[model samples]
Target: MNKKKTSLLPKNFLFRLTFINIFIVSIFIALSSWAVYNTACFLVDSMGTMTGTNQTKFNKTLYYYLWIFSLIAMITGSIAHFYLTKRLIHPLKRLIESTKSMKKGNYPEPIEVTSSDEIGQLTSNFNGLAHQLKKNHEQRQKLVMDLSHEVRTPLANLNGYLYALKNGVIEGDPALYESLYQESERLTKMITQLETLKEWDYISEQSFFEKEMAPIGKLLHETVKMFEWQLKEKQIAVEIDAEDADLLVDKEGVLQAISNLTENAIRFYSGEGIISIKGERLANEYYIAITGPSYPITEKEGEKLFERFYRVDPSRSRDTGGSGLGLSITKEIIEQHKGDIGWKTDEAKNTFWFTLPLETACTSR
Candidate 1:
């Protein structure tokens, strides 16, 4: 048996380009031939007696040359079309392959940018997307690990206590009961905050905010009131210097954002220091900030504070109990409202501030 011979023409896109170029060349040759024939006829008619043997020979030669030129034009057009189309489509082919790799949970190496064109820009954007996906994947895996450890520790303690009680290995007393209750409560709080964090994450992704015309001062006051007991216990005075302004915002979401900032301030406040809560409108934006005692943190550390499960204090003590999801949730909430949230620290104090559009539309960025 003989092997079938492969066609030399490029396949797929290149083949289509080849066909198109040949068709265009054929049309151009046909139109040129028609024009030339009409011009020759005009010249023969003008030369009245010149239409003889020479005219016949000239017509034959003209047709022969036209055929040869048409063949050359078609061949040249096909070759050029194939070469250029192949080069243009090579980047797209790589992009498709990279996307396939990403679909399989593999982050392929960045494709080299070969030109300063739209194609290069597209390649650059794809690389950026891949980097972000890879980063998110690593963060997700880390979050799961952290979540398991957080849940397991408290459950293990509860299991141990229950087992001891059942086997009569330890006596059930007030202190023991209180300890078990605290463990359970901690576990519940962690789980609850985790749920809240996840909820806000979804809300942020969907850009879901129930906007209402709410008084900024009232919202700030309400958030402060929620921490009244804690404030009194710590002797931390909350001074609210807010100007009354009606903002188009999600009432509950803004309250939660303010509450998270206040909570963190109280948790890390210097002894008997004032927690300054300020709200004001500057130009087209509503600014809200909670300033408290400065912790030992750098600018980079402050940036990471908005990330889920990222704790500012390394101790992770029960006294300052947090699942490290509050700030993350707050960030999501503020962002969903097309607002910006950030923290700034001086030597004496750190101010966590967020800004929202003063004249916010129902569905605006």
Candidate 2:
């Protein structure tokens, strides 16, 4: 025989609680009735005029009435208990079904909030989690598709060039070889960036980062100096206004983030334009901003600017030899430090800014 799984008691939380409360109440009533009957018997025994028959009759009448009253109370309590349990368990059951749907990759209708209680709060949290999971899953799908498209172009070009050379359709001229080498180099760079992004994703997901109190101003200055050659090549003037501020962060990660921002500024700034770097303390955080002259970007484009392989201008990204992962990596680094990074633009300038929490106790490295 196929036996269905069964629970000895109600599995719903409210039902179980009600059952326990009723059981305790019943025990109290029974004890009280016993005490009342014993007191009645003692009083009757003290009266000499009362006979055995009278005593027996009195006891029977008292016990019968007590049983009837207890039965009435139990029935009333059970009716009230059932009503209360229904109100509370209905929402919980809906929530359980929603979760099961989510497990099957189906996002069903949201649970309705019927009350302001712990259960209601739990429902709200569950809704938020479901929304987040759906968003992340969509983003993951888009990332995979984008990555595939990005890799295919370079790969196709490399394959075509190599095939042409193999068939003797193209001579072993130095220029032809150089072109082939550049295509291969582009692929290598893309692969390297992909690997770096993967590592960064792992680190961010694991909340893993080395923390040390490091000077923010010095880091910004050093990062700017590292790009001096590019700044000069682009004929871009540099301005720096940094204050002494220390932050607890992964030093290498911070350095890399600053370097990436500076490199981005150098790449996009108009020739002979100025790039400004600023670092200062803002309340409890050290803020760093990099501003450069560039074309304006729409709000929609700016929203996905930090997404891997996303580019404000695809042609500009190619011309500048960008892999389109720098900002994404920098965003992760800043977020790992429990901070924020974003971009803002005006008619004359484009600014990328980030912040890190300031370390109160400064320590020398």
Candidate 3:
């Protein structure tokens, strides 16, 4: 059972506002009438009682006109006050309704901004917030669907293996167990990477990092060292041609970004090849590029290289032990450090590059 929540404000809030404004106007009018009356009486008394009858007639006429003017002002002023109050309160009412819609998980249409006042600004800000929330909601839905798609195959594989073992349709062998374990491990790794991508996506907004001034060249060297065994196994030679420029960045994040790029290079290298890693300072930015052998990718494919779960060759990536989120995580880390990441193809070689601002406060492109 659910109960509807009650609002704190009264239903006749606009009426109350109108009444309060009219009450204030009436107070001012009454004070003015009292002052005028006192002044008229003083003037009449100052006439030294010479024209007593005339003064009496003048006092009556003055009082009568004063009462009539006050009556007229009160009526007209109340009507105008009510109209203006209604105009101001109408937008607030619309905002409240829009808020309720959002609370019910339905995004509302943009509220019209009809003024250059604070209320108009508030409405504009609310529209921007609604747009962002709607975008996030859509992305979340897509993520759930993509996650289910990625999980289903591995789960099916594991279920088939378990069913066969339980039904005694096939004897359990070491190879069978290894295959099942591999499927389970792939599922675990995909989920872990998805969680990592989610965490970094959130952390990017907060700018959370342990930033330090580190040499770009040294970071590249360290990243290459981390993958020495894999590079040697693949017979891939990594050559670093980097400038020893200092960058203000999070060392752990930068290292992770570089490591992802390096691992990607090793994974996609066509046969035994040389992977060139270059870092240079261009203007106020430190640029890093990793060039290695890869299959031809179109401009459209290149554009989506950093999107989560995106793969140019999904089977090839899976066989190479990729979760299809390495580049996405790298992009997140680079952007969080106020940088840009992209890729380009030249002949048979593909180059993945990124740029970091020399100053940590610079905006990302």
Candidate 4:
């Protein structure tokens, strides 16, 4: 069977709108001409002395005038309809062309919003979406470049050390071996964090939380316990103040988030400083905060603290500052639990806090 060929012109919105408008105009012209013709006939018939020949002539003249009027009306209506349709469909055409350009990875200028109609709203939304996509593209490119630079530095160091030792350019001293090992360790840590971040990115928010509800106080205690050795090494005093609150969360995910925050606090705290963990129930949510003494961070830096690969102290070595993905992972975990995480800094302290919804708090009561 042969498929029917479709006319591209008729498929256009302008063509369809103009055709419908012209059809309506034709109907109105026909009805108007009929009414006028009928009125003329009625007036002629009412003239009692009118002869058949005169009547026929008058009727023919009336029909001729009606035909002329109809033709004029049709021509004028068609021209007006075409102009109106073109105005209405011009924006749509621009949108289609812009989308095609975007498909080719070229974002042209924003679609001009000419009206407050649905099409105008759509144009505005498209502009916003294009801007966001361009921003994300730039960020992704930067991330790739940064990742390469980070990995290359450690790898190059390791390679240089190994090559020097193999060629007898440098003795295989214990310090040299330790340095090489540390470089290898840094590379492994960064790679592992990257993989973990990728997996976390793929996880959906709905499935992030497990069905079990864990006590906030207990989780905080356990998380602090895990960092006992680090706390001791740093001589950081610990304090915990928590309310008895249960949160609907993924047990392991929440644990890891708290652990990361604690570890962050431990790493950045001043020598022999105090680390405080606080938890409290606020309405339908439970809030957890970990604070430590440190130099104040600007509000701007705090805003980006949870972003992947963001470092507070840019000069600090990765070995001391970590892969910079720990806080990012923690942010993701808290967000997946329908929570918010942020940091605040004062004159002599920095605090990281997060809130998780108490899903059954009211029901249990």
lDDT tens per residue, model 1, 161-242: 9999999999999999998998888778778887887777667646355678888888899999999999888777879998
Q: How much is the lDDT of residue 220 in candidate 2?
A: 83
lDDT of 3 at 304: 75
Tens digits of per-residue lDDT for model 3 on 8-119? 3424786787788788888999899989988988877897874878878877888899889998999998888778777777788788888989999999999999998998
Task: Name model 4 segments beyond 4 Å from true.
Answer: 1-51, 100-105, 109-125, 171-178, 195-214, 228-237, 248-253, 283-285, 293-308, 331-340, 345-349, 357-365
Query: Could you give me the TM-score of model 1 versus the true structure?
Result: 0.75
TM-scores, one per candidate: 0.75, 0.76, 0.88, 0.72
Superposed on all Cα atoms, model 3 deviates from the true structure by an RMSD in Å of 3.8
Instruction: Count clashing residue pairs per candidate.
Output: 0, 0, 0, 0
Q: Per-residue lDDT for 1-365 in model 4, tens only? A: 12122223323667778788889889989999999998988898898668989888888899999999899989998998798778877777777777778888987788788898998898899998888788768867977986987778788888888898889898987887888888888788788877766666656423434457677788899998999998788778899999887666678888989988898888778744688899988887888999999778887777778878787764657767777888988887778777899988867898999998876653222
> Lowest-lDDT window of 10 residues in candidate 1?
1-10
Order by TM-score, highest first: 3, 2, 1, 4
Pairs that clash in candidate 2: none
Task: Note the Cα lDDT for every prediction shown.
Answer: 0.81, 0.79, 0.83, 0.81
User: Could you say which candidate leads in lDDT?
Assistant: 3
How much does each candidate deviate from the true structure in C-alpha RMSD? 5.4, 4.5, 3.8, 5.9
